[model samples]
Target: MAYISVLKLILSVYCFFTLFILCSTAPELCNFPAIFNFGDSNSDTGGFSAALFSLPPPYGQTFFHMPAGRYSDGRLIIDFIAESLNLPHLQAYLDSLESNFTHGANFATSASTIRLPNRVLPCGSGFSPFYLNVQYGQFHQFKSRADFIRTRGDIFGSLLPREEDYLRALYTFDIGQNDLGEGFFRNKTIKQVYASIPDIINQFTVDVTNIYWVGARSFWIHNTGPVGCLPYILTTFKTAGKDSAGCAKAYNEVAKYFNLKLKEAIGQLRKELPSSAFTYVDVYSVKYSLFTHPKKYGFELPLVACCGYGGKYNYNNEVTCGYTLKMKNGSEIVVGACEKPWKRVNWDGIHYTEAANKFVFNKISTGAFSDPPRPLKQSCFNPS
Candidate 1:
């Protein structure tokens, strides 16, 4: 009788332990019907290309087999995100041809800044006129216009997202890098740049608030990456102190400062908007890891552009990638991509290759780098 009682007790304990494990580890995923993305080239599907001019070939050769309006050699992190959620890739809101927005729309454009720029692209400033505020305005217009178009009951209605999806959509942001770059390009002092971060974050907060008012509840915001580690900053600021990994130390510190402020602002937003779910993704850490430990990630030439013109970092502002340059001897040469882009981190001095972006997406999607430690699929779960 005693042996039988002991056996029963052990069985009960084992069952309890198994149940606890199953309950704790079971997946708690959010069913986000759509994704409304906003930002710069980091997540731009084709906004810049549609709004301005289409990018030349070799831009999307790795994945899309042609210029797909992305700056990288293939898909961006946003593309991986959409794929993970089982949703169709978002079409640029600015794109009119061959676009379908049933799942959602992308409002990101290359060279976009959180703050308005004094000058824009093609005019030599290299910044996009569609800044953060302008993106918000576009989104506001899209919301109303899409609803209006859906009422028409035609093929266009099928292409637009369902009205209910707006409330359940995952709102993503990947801007602010260009704001810092803009300041640096203007030769602003580090202190001046530091001082400008607050206003920049405030602008971001206001747009987010406006978006919230428009029924967006789940927000997944990405902090700016390591600007100092990029080939553009490294080659431009030759005198900046280099870390052991070859990244510029001072510029990286400035980026860190911006991220710190942005995180704090997010915390405040959580308080102010109690009903919303906010996920702060530390992409800077993930991206910086590539520079610090490139070999661990199966990458080489971490700071060199894979598809840029002649230079120490294989980048040139004068002769950018895919641009045809005329030599003095009347010969024309087109700057082309390297033989292997998968083994490289930087794509064209300003963006990450598809491999690097995939690595980043894999890391951050695991929730290890999120503020609340929630996976990408579970981002809508509010801990507060």
Candidate 2:
């Protein structure tokens, strides 16, 4: 009898442990029907670079083994987010020749802007002279992108008719960093640009609200990261006493101010679009944490870029990373990468590596940056 009782106790304990493991690992049911992504290089799959005439290496070497037009190695935050939801990486609307939009699409561009066009210039001039021209052009691109979606929606709707029932989807907007980097910071003083953040964010809110009116039911918006910490800023503007370890307080503070206002703007949007779900993903904090606590996140080099000349910028924006190499005495001369690529934080002066993007995606999906009232919960589940 004693032996039988001990056996039963052991069986019960085993069952309990099994149940706990299953519960912890089980996937949650995804509430979203689809995902729509709009942003710059951080989330852009291959839209802008593909559109451009120039081809650069070291662009997609991290993931695709060749340049896929993505700025990172393999996948980005949006790609990971799609995977977490059991969805494929968002397709570029431009690449939708057949209009098969079963999983939604990405309409982001590397150097795109959200503001209205201020002027118009001839095509292939390298830059869109005015904000209005770029805005209208991008809007047209967005419309073209949507046409592709409609085509896919029509086909998918016929096959999976219930998809429309869950038509409510998540849309992530992650742009504006370039506008600051190229436009404001390039010419104006940090003080001047800092003063204009409210205006920029306000206009962004309006643009996002318009997107919401179109078809975005759930939104994930991201604010700018700490620009001062970027390799370009650190190298170009570092004071005599301020080293790479110490970032410019003023620049970081401005980013904080912008983030605060952005949070407020999101709050207002939530109140205005009460029926829709809007979540803000704080990219600033995630990237900053990587720099501040590199060891905690398993990174060793926080400030250095994996590709680029060993200089202030740590990047040659005019040239691609791995694909293009200058030869000296029959030896290739290029930016040196860290010994442990995965352990480094910054891939280039401005971008994160595939691993870093994965880390950021996990945080966003888990509600590390979500606002209250609609925090992220489990995303999948398995009955077995």
Candidate 3:
């Protein structure tokens, strides 16, 4: 009798553990009808490309086998999110009007800032839109158009974003890095630049509110990663020797300061919008974790950029990655993609390679890094 009772208890524990494991890894358990994203180079599907000529070689070589306007060698974090949702790659809002929008649209652009910078040049060259506010306006235009043919036979002749579709879509934001990046370009010390973080966050909260009012009840917000860890930053801020991970000390601290405030603001937003589900992702810590344990994330080099020119970290002001440069000696020098892009973490000194992005997305999907502490698959789960 005692032996039989022990077996029953063991079976019950086994069943519970199996159920927990299934819930943790089953991203398909929850369905997200669509996903809409906004940010800078970190998530831009092709916003910069649509506004300008197509990106040069080595930019999208990893996945697209050609330049698709992404800053990285391949997919961005937003791409991973779309894939997880079982949707086609999100099209850029600026893409051709005929482009498919069944999965939603990407409004991110390279060099975009959450707020306008002291100079607009960094906002993307020519008619290219890169400010978060401008991206929102582009979204407004796309929403107004009823030209999009959904996979299902639903017509959008109604109001922009059609109430039902907007309610079902997942909204994501990955901006604010360019705001801090601009601070560095203007030669502001950490102390001086840190002062602006509050205003930056204030604008972000306001934007979230506006988006919330627009019927977007589900939001996934990514905090800025460790900027000091980027090869470009190390090249510029070489004041102190590299930390144990080959990152700059002061620059990383500034990033941490911004992340702390951002997290607090998200909590406040949760309080203000009780009906909305806001998941704050700790991207900074996740990226840093990969930097510390590169092998675990399938990276052999975390500090050295895969495509760059000159110096220890291979980053320079004149010639960045994926661009061909004309030299004074009458020769064209092309800095292309690395032989093993998947083995490296940083791509072109700023963006991440596809492999690194996949790892980060997988980590976030596990629900371990979220603010409210639910898996990403559950973001769209509606509880009565």
lDDT of 1 by residue, 1-384 (tens): 999999999999999999999999877788999999999999999998998978998899999999999999999999999999999888999999988889989999999998888678879767998898899999999989989998998888998889988888999999999999988999998889999999999999999999899879999999999999998998899899999989999999999999999999999999999988999999999999999999998999899999998778999888888999899999998989999899999999999999999999999999999998989998883443
Question: What is each predicted model's overall lDDT from 0 to 1?
Answer: 0.93, 0.65, 0.81
- RMSD values for the candidates in order, in angstroms, are 1.9, 6.1, 4.1
Residue pairs clashing in model 3 are none
Model 2, CA-based lDDT: 0.65
After TM-score superposition, what is the CA distance of residue 302 in candidate 3 from its true location, in Å? 1.5
lDDT of 2 at 56: 60
What alpha-carbon RMSD in Å does predicted model 3 have with respect to the real structure?
A: 4.1
Order of models, best TM-score first: 1, 3, 2
Clash count per candidate: 0, 16, 0
* Segments in model 1 whose C-alpha atoms lie over 4 Å from true places: 1-21, 24-27, 381-384
